[model samples]
Target: MLIDPHLLAVFTVTTIVALVTPGPDMLFVLGCGVRGGARAGLLATVGVITGDALYIAAAAGGLAVLLTAFPVVFTALRIVGGAYLIYLGVQMIRNRKKGQTDDPAAGGMSGRRAFLNGMVSSMANPQTFTFMVAFLPQFIDPAAGPIWLQFLVLGAILIVLEFVADGTVGVLAGRIGGWLRARQAVRRRIDAATGSVFIALGIRLAAER
Candidate 1:
């Protein structure tokens, strides 16, 4: 992934915006970190990166054709993904607890489990894939380089940004898990807020063509 100045600026700006936005992915990672630990959260971050890389490849490839060819399939995927996000949000709302002691079981989520959870959550959200398909082409310059190569470069930038942001949140969550547990009301509010974001993002995604 060659990072030219222009591309770097665009990539950096987009990444910054995306990283700051709290979404299903962010909430999941934060929750996992608080529940499991930094190691688990890091593993989950890797899983999500894997999913992002896969989508990048898929978008660079001809998979967009499949989506474009079958609009209904894309719609179905959006509906399913949206529903899953809502379900996850509801779970967060229900699970928020205040003034709880640190339970080792809760923090013992295996790295493999974290990785799988991250990958599955990312894969289930068809909007990510669709967004890749839609957004990538605009930045691509076939005369500048191979389309696939350009895409890989762009995707790598996104992943690096994602890792830095999500990883930071995970580490921070690990450090503050105890404190957060003591503040049940705050946890509840965070959960509720994150849930609302997920529902809103899902709705926006579903409304997209």
Candidate 2:
């Protein structure tokens, strides 16, 4: 086995526990869902997964070691990412005011944009890179197989689990958002709330050491 079965099981359980907790990635998906709808939410999740795949590759290649060694780089990345998120939140609020929801072309959140947003958001999160570097290696066994292959296998398992957990949250949030969108007043409120979530997340990320 590329990974010890017992270790794999333990990793799976630990990952599931982590996923169930409301974290930055999950909250970001939830915001996208509430802002855009189910399809947008799903696209965002895919984007996040794609970004995660790249991070895994980086970790396997030892790029994560370089990143971790440079505390300034990590801090700079977090600040930039947080600022971008704040920008997104502000834009969302502006779009709400402009009634962009009624017109797809008027700065409405499109699927491609959602996907890109998710990808960017995921990549911007330094914590994800750090987590991959710190966590994934715990289960790896150099004696079992090629180290890179082991990383891929473990990464695949994590992505699948993330998709299931985060995807469900996105879809459910989208449904609720869709329903609320039927009422104009409620729709505006939903937009505001969603924007707030992004802003809050941004602040939290920026402030985190």
Candidate 3:
């Protein structure tokens, strides 16, 4: 086995706990679902997964080493990412009124836009890369096989679990949003709530060392 069985089990449980905790990515997906629909939600998940896959690849390629060697670079990236998220949150809040239209086509974000938003949001979070670098290595066992292969295996598992959890949240949110679409007031509240989540996440990310 590329990874120790015991370590793998522990990692799985840890990942589940982490996923279940409401975080930026999950909340972003929820916002997308509420604004768009089920299709947009699922596409957003795909985009986020794709971003994670890229980060895994980068981590396997020694990006962690680069980050460790230049802490300033990481700091700069973190600040920029946090700023971008904040900008997005503010935009959402400002545009809440525009999203009050009864026609989904007119008010809701398109599927392509949702996917891109998810991808951009995921990639913009330097914390994701930092987390991958810090978290994935614990389960690796040099005696088991190649380190890179182990990273890939662990990354694959993480991605699958993320999809399962995030996808469910998106779909469920989309359904509820659909049901409540008739109420303009509800729509406004949903937009405000989602935007607040994004702003809070951004502040949290920016503040965290």
Q: Of the candidates shown, which would achieve the greatest TM-score relative to the real structure? A: 2
The alpha-carbon RMSD values of the candidates against the true structure, listed in the order shown, are 4.2, 1.9, 2.0
Task: Give the alpha carbon lDDT tens digit for every residue of 1-209 in model 1.
Answer: 34457866886797688677986567667766665567777887887778878889877887777877887876786677667666655666666553334543332346897687677667556656765888777777777878888888888888888999888887787566645534555555655665565556556555655
Distance from true location, Cα of 156 in model 3, Å: 0.3
TM-score of each: 0.72, 0.93, 0.89
Clashes of each: 1, 0, 0
- Of 2 and 3, which scores higher on lDDT? 2
* lDDT of each residue in 1-209, candidate 3, tens digit only: 56777999999999999888987889889988886777788888888888889889988887778877997887776677667767777887898788466664346667897787787667667667767888898888888898889999999999999999999988988888887655777777777777787787677667767
Q: Which pairs of residues collide in candidate 2?
A: none
lDDT of 2 by residue, 145-206 (tens): 99989998999999999999999998998887777676666767777877888888788778
Model 2, position 166: C-alpha lDDT score = 90
Candidate lDDT (C-alpha), each: 0.69, 0.83, 0.80
Off by over 4 Å in 2: 100-108
**Residue 29: error of model 2 in Å?**
0.7
The 10-residue segment of model 2 with minimum total lDDT is 100-109
- Which candidate ranks first by lDDT, i.e. highest? 2
Off by over 4 Å in 3: none
Q: Looking at candidate 1, what is the lDDT of residue 116?
A: 74
